[model samples]
Structures are given as structure tokens and as C-alpha cells.
Target: MAGTTEPYDVITMGRTGVDIYPLQTGVSLADVETFGKFLGGSATNVAVAAARLGRRTAVISRTGRDPFGDYVHKALREFGVDDRWVTPVERYPTPVTFCEIFPPDDFPLYFYRRPKAPDLVIQPEELDLDAIRAARVFWITGTGLCEEPSRSATLAALEARAKSGTTVFDLDWRPLFWGGEGGASGAGGATGATAMATARPYYEAALAHTTVAVGNLDEAEVATGLRDPHACARALLDMGVELAVIKQGPRGVLAVHRDGRTAEVPPTPVEVVNGLGAGDAFGGALCHGLLAGRPLEDVMRHANAAGALVAGRLACSSAMPTADELEKFLASR
Candidate 1:
């Protein structure tokens, strides 16, 4: 499947799966309704977003030999993500997230993740280091670091990319994946803060190889233990990253460079629909902008616009704007 003379602009390495939802508006846990399924995962979302934005993108992940796996592969292809490095396994079942979104407030969404999901079995041998080395940027997430073979596999990919001088972009923190204990599942019904505490080592390992680090206000606070966005961004920069971007949601984004420069790019105005996948859109667009050698301010603006577009739409992947759409939005601003 590795038939290409051209190198990809970005290669995403992390989890891939389907999102099974039983969702409705203004409902509670007791007032559930109909359910729908969608193809989703952080790395997959970023890869699709980058591809749709006219960048050469590839996704390296493992999926089960099940119907959900088939759906994920087909969905990635439909979104123009290059799947040459995807490995389909026969043993483990593809990961499926059974989510119930409590309506009206959009905050109390509950998730049921199956144990030993296919994506969790991503071993080092499953990845093609040559393909990883050929990429300009390697996009990764913190959720994938919650498990064993997948964690080592991601680290190996990053190491290969680092040796080849490829820029590593890390989304520093994800509390849900840490579970209860310090491992995959949580220990003793720990709170979100405790789960986040368990994610520190993974974050530190990722930060060691990252050139660009991106996180929202809450994620930033968790990773660096700093509430101030600027201070958090600065702290991340001090950790050897050349660039740090703190996403402030409706407040926009704050970007800081190692050279002592900073900028705050405001988000574009749009109607809010679903906020899912917006961070991936922003991260993907920011990677695209960096690969294109766009100025820092321009990168933030592009990411902000891309994020706003994702927030304004219903479907996760369907909401990602095209390059032309992003350009138009930027020009108007």
C-alpha cells in the first residue's frame, strides 16, 4: 500500500474508531431517545480535517476486522485521508464508544468504552517508520498513551520522526482515557482531577519530543498546572517546544513562540451546533499552516476559522471546511 513518490505533509498516529451515540436535546439519563452512529476519533478527525484542507495527510492506526473497522476505513477514504499505513487486525474488536449525551446543557455526556479495543493493540511492528519519517509533521494525541502496546508504538513513531527532523505536534492532555488507576482504567472512582493527575507522565513523555504543543484552557491548566493561558503557554514553551497555542474556545486562541513573541487570534463568529472535533480542526489547520510556512498570526487565524467552522456544524467530520472556505473566511477578516 505504500506506493507514493511524494511525502505527506502530515501523518497522524493515534486512536481510530466509531462513535455510537444515543443522543437528544433537553433530555436526561432517564429521558433517553433514539441513537445514531458516527465515525470519529481524535487522530482520525485531525487527519481528515488536514486532508480536506488540501494537505497531503496519512493516518497510521490499527482497527479490528469487524464492521465498525470497515466503516472507519471507508469513512477515512471518503474524507481523502491516505490509509496506506492502516493495519486491520482479526483478533480484537474495533473500538466503539457508546455515548449518551444529556441534552439542554451539553455537559453531562456519558461514555461506555469497551475493554481491549482494536486500536489499543497498535504495536510497533504495525507502523511503517519510513512513512512516518517522510511526513513533515507527526500529529498525536494523549488518549492513545493510556494503554500499553499503543503507547510504545506512538513513542516509537515519534522517535523515528524526531530522528528524521519531522516536527512533532502533541495534544497534551486527555483525562477520560486515564480511567481510575494510573493505567488505562481509573482507580477507586477517582474524580476528573485525579484522572488528569495520572496523565502527567504521558504528557511529559510526549512533550519531550514535541515541537508544537496545542491545548485548550482546561487542558493547559491540567498539563502545566497553571490557570493563566499566557503563563501556561510560556511554561509549555520552556519545556523545549518551539511553539505553543492555547485554545480559548469562544475567547479565541493565544499563540506563543520561543522567541518571545505572542499573538491572540479571535474566533470567527458563527452559530453553535456541536463543539466536538473543533480542537482537532484547529490543530490540523495549525499544522497545515506551519507546513505551508505561513506566519504565526496567519496560522492562528486559519485555525480559529477552521475551529469556528467545526463548531458551527452538526456532523464532526462533515463540518470541517475546505481550504477555499477557510481562505474566504480569513480574507473577510
Candidate 2:
């Protein structure tokens, strides 16, 4: 479904759903702990953040004709994201993610995603290709590429956008969403090693279309099998991406461009209330900076500040800072 009008400044294509009951500190599946629901999913979070920053943003994805879907729509609207391109399928229920936030320990946090959720059933026909082609930048996430008609649809959209001169941005590599396969969630029965194998092809497909690539330190290690941050960033750049940003969390961010320039941006120190959506905030701000023609160094700095701000907050979308707030933070630094 191609849109009839010309492209926007930025349009995001990927999954959309709800995150039900994210556990608070010390919460686990065994004992009762406080939980809070937030509009989750990587692509949606970035879209909301970009829109709130006053960008003309649109989202292309599928959701179920259920309460969760309605909530997703309402949240996007409230954040000023254009939802005209979002499709609602009545056959399936919307997807939900349940995660357990453990007490502060040396171990990493754990997450559990539901299988074969509605957001995973997106087909090529469900997308509004015209709108995708009309955008100056098309942003996507690795989680959405972990499944079927949606996977093919995502590739198609990227190809179309590329031909139209739209910059294609990819947040590479999420192993959990890939299921057991090496591709998107691996074959349904996949588990352990088998699932990881199933998700590989989809990852390759995504990498082929990526113009700007972003990932955290662990993801960079997984994606390129390289421990050195600079080498990992260079590997992505060699894969034909114009820019590569490796988010090092508390350590900050490192960016490399095809023009042989590199920038290291330090993270802003803040007490982290919740670490969710920080990557999405960084992605959105990075896109905004690039689209506005800011220098790569400044873009990395802005993105670093945005990510730090989001990480210090408890809510996902609500944690995103306003333009004025972002400016204030920048000035104070």
C-alpha cells in the first residue's frame, strides 16, 4: 500500500505492542513485586521520541484489533506520531511483553517475550509503502525482522526507500526476539542454539539495507563477533553503512562515518531509575540531528544526552525529553 503523497522527514517501520507489568526492583516471577505497563517495542519508542522532538514522523506497522492495539494507537497519538500508516488486523490479538526487573546485581536483566504475537504477523500488503518512500529517513529495528511476512515486507520497504534516496537506519541485533533460530525468532519449535541459527538470515537481510547502524556494546560484539568497539564499528561501516554508532551505555557512545571520521561522545551521568527506551531515544535523536544537517560530532553528543536522560527515568515513552529540556541539558553541560 503505497502512500499517495510525497515523503515526510522521517518514517519508522517496525513492530508495535504493549509491555505489560515490567517488574520493579527485586521483582520476580516467583514473588510478588510492583509492575507497570508502558508502551514498549523499539521502533514505536523511537517514533514517539522523534515526533515529540517536533519532527514530522510517521509509523508503519501492524497491530491487533484489541485493547492493546488501541492503547498503542492512543499513546502514539498522544506523543504526536502520525498513525495513518499503521494497520490493524482483526484476526489476531496484539502482542504483549512481560519482563522481570531484578535487583541491582552483577548479572544482566532478564526478559521473556510471548511467542507468535500479533505484531509478528505483519505482511507486505499491510504496509503503506508510499509513505515509507516519502520519508527522508526510514528507521527499523532488529526485533521486527525476526518474523515472516513482516520480514519480507521490511526488506521490500528498505529497498524502495533506498531507491528513492531515503536513508535507511537499522538498530542491529536482538537475540531474544530472534527466538531459537538464527533469523527472526527462529523456526517456531526452535530453542537454544537452533533458534539462534534461524535468526541469522533475517539479520543479514536487515544489514544489507542499513544506511546508519546502531547497537549497544554487547550487540556489537554479537553482530560482528568483534570485542574491540572501534573494529566492530568499522565492520559495520565496511558493510556499506554510512555511519555506525556503538552505544557503550554508562561509558558513552562511539561513532564512525564512511568519510573516515570518528567521534567519541561521553555519557551524561544520572541516577538510572530504569534503563528501558534509552537506545530508542538515542536512535531518534541521532536521526533528528542527521536530518537537520548537524555535524556528526554534535549529533553523537545530542544522542548521548538524550539516551542518558531516558535511562535516568522510570517510564519508556514518558522518559523522553522535550526539545526545551534537551536544550537545557545541553547548555548545563
Candidate 3:
């Protein structure tokens, strides 16, 4: 969204890793014969998505001194994402995620993060404040707030938005990473109540600093303890979000804007393939529209089309469509 003079249009800072998926669907990870690997992590996906949409994008994160890290770099460059800020550390190993595919993506992920991933070590000192402040749009996710230094660093990056830029919070919440009384390892597992209480303060603080908050119904519920879309939007808006959106898969996305305006884009039909990448696609396209300063209705519809294009695709990052592709898809509907 930044003009040609700016170094980047969109910038993202957060966790990134390798995603390994079993090639065969309807099979368990234990039984899968072959697998495919790709660049992943929510923020990384959003970067790739926006880049594919023709925005100059950059990602700020670290990977381990391993082949997986190499793969991540190559994948980002191949997708036109600037990885100049992507670091590689010697002792730590890059995180790897593996999942068994069920039809339409009923995939449960197994994250290999026992020793702590390098991304969790992104200290505040390492950030490029100039790059963060210069971008037209900056995005971060809840997972980045799950740990310490990364959490501090993520908050610091948000500071740039205050100066000039749009800050987007993708509530990429993973209960498994929140580790404690309401964390993944809890005896009976973290309940919705515990999860809500544990996640609220963190979400609230970040939401206070962010301008745009994007999440699905469950994510909104976890962050605000509200299931009703309207209440959820109000709570987020109360936290100072200029715009709050709830992405309802089959129904549509409900959006509440600052000027007492709201917009909804009903689901666009597509042959469902794997549902893993739609949200990321939505984030990318949404950045495009917002950066263009397009109206809320146009923005919502454009974002819906972007996600719909990926819903029926085979992979994640590569599934994101270009601007021309998105417009064509929308024209069809």
C-alpha cells in the first residue's frame, strides 16, 4: 500500500517456521507415506499473501541454523517477500510443524518446539524501528505475544504504528502455546473460561495499541469473552480498535468501524479443498484494501474474494491470488 518510494507496503513481525504436511488426505500422521513442506507461521503467511497481491512486503523474525531455515528464506524470496530482517541463529533449531490432512483441512498440528524456537528470542534490540515505522501496514499475531522477549519486541514494534502506519492484530491464538493453568498442558486441557481469562489481558493490551483487529468468531470470543459477533466487535472497538472484524466461515465477515459504520460480506462460494490458508489470505487482501484507503464495503468484499480463492487450493502461501486474480474472481460472483 505504501507508494513506490517507500521500502515496503506491508511489514510483519512474529513467529515463522516450516510446515510439513502429509501428501495423502484422510490419513494419520503415523501412516502418511509422503509429505510436502512449505513456509508457514501466521505472520509469515500474511507477508507472502500480501506480496502475492502485489504489495512490497517484508518479514521480521528468526529461524534456526538448519535446513528448515534455509527453506524458509528460499520460500520467502520466491514469493517476493523481503527477508533481509529474517535472522538465523546458530545453537537453536528452527521449529517444524507436521499435520495429517483430512478432507477440507481437519489438520491437527504437531509443533516441534521443545527447546524453544528462535523466533521466541526476537529481542527488542534486534528490531529495525525505521522499517517498522516506514511501512504502510504492519501485522502481528497473538502467538508472538505468547512468549517473553518476542512479546516485548512485538509491543515495541506496535509503537511504530502510533507514529505513522496501520497496525493489524491477527488473533492467531493457539491455546497450546499459552502453557500454564489454562495452557495446553493442563490436566483436563484449558477450558474456554480459563483460556479467556488467560488471553484477555494480553489481547487487551495489544488491542489497545492496534488500529485494526482481525479474527474469527472463536478468536474474538477468546480475546473478549463474547460470542455474539456484535458484542465482540463492541468490546474490541472499546479497546480502541478502529475496526474489528469477525470472520464467519459460511455466513460472512462482520465488521464494525469507528464512525459507527458496519459492513458484512457474505461468504463467496468456492469448491472447498483445504481451509488452512483462507484467513491468512484474508489478512493480506484486507491490508491491500485498507492501504488503498478503499471504502469498508469494498475492502470487505475484496478480502472475501481473496480468502475464497485460497479455500479451494492445495497449499497455503502459494494459494494466495494476485490482484488481477482477485478482481476476476469477484467479477464472477
lDDT per residue as tens, model 2, 203-249:
55666777787888666655565768899898877777888889886
Give all TM-scores, in the order shown: 0.89, 0.88, 0.93
Candidate 3 lDDT at 111 equals: 82
Clashes of each: 6, 21, 0
Candidate lDDT scores, in order, read: 0.75, 0.72, 0.84
Q: Report the lDDT tens digits of candidate 1 across residue range 161-190.
A: 773544655564656667732234455224
**How well does candidate 1 match the true structure in TM-score terms?**
0.89
**Alpha-carbon error at 63 in model 3, in Å?**
0.4
Q: State the lDDT at 22 in candidate 1.
A: 54
Instruction: Compose the digit string of candidate 3's lDDT tens values, residues 200-276.
Output: 78888888889899999889987888889989999999988999989988889999998898998898889777778
Where is the poorest 10-residue window by lDDT in model 3? 180-189
Candidate numbers sorted by lDDT from highest down: 3, 1, 2
Against the true structure, candidate 2 reaches a TM-score of 0.88
Predictions ranked by TM-score, top down?
A: 3, 1, 2
Model 3 gets an lDDT of: 0.84
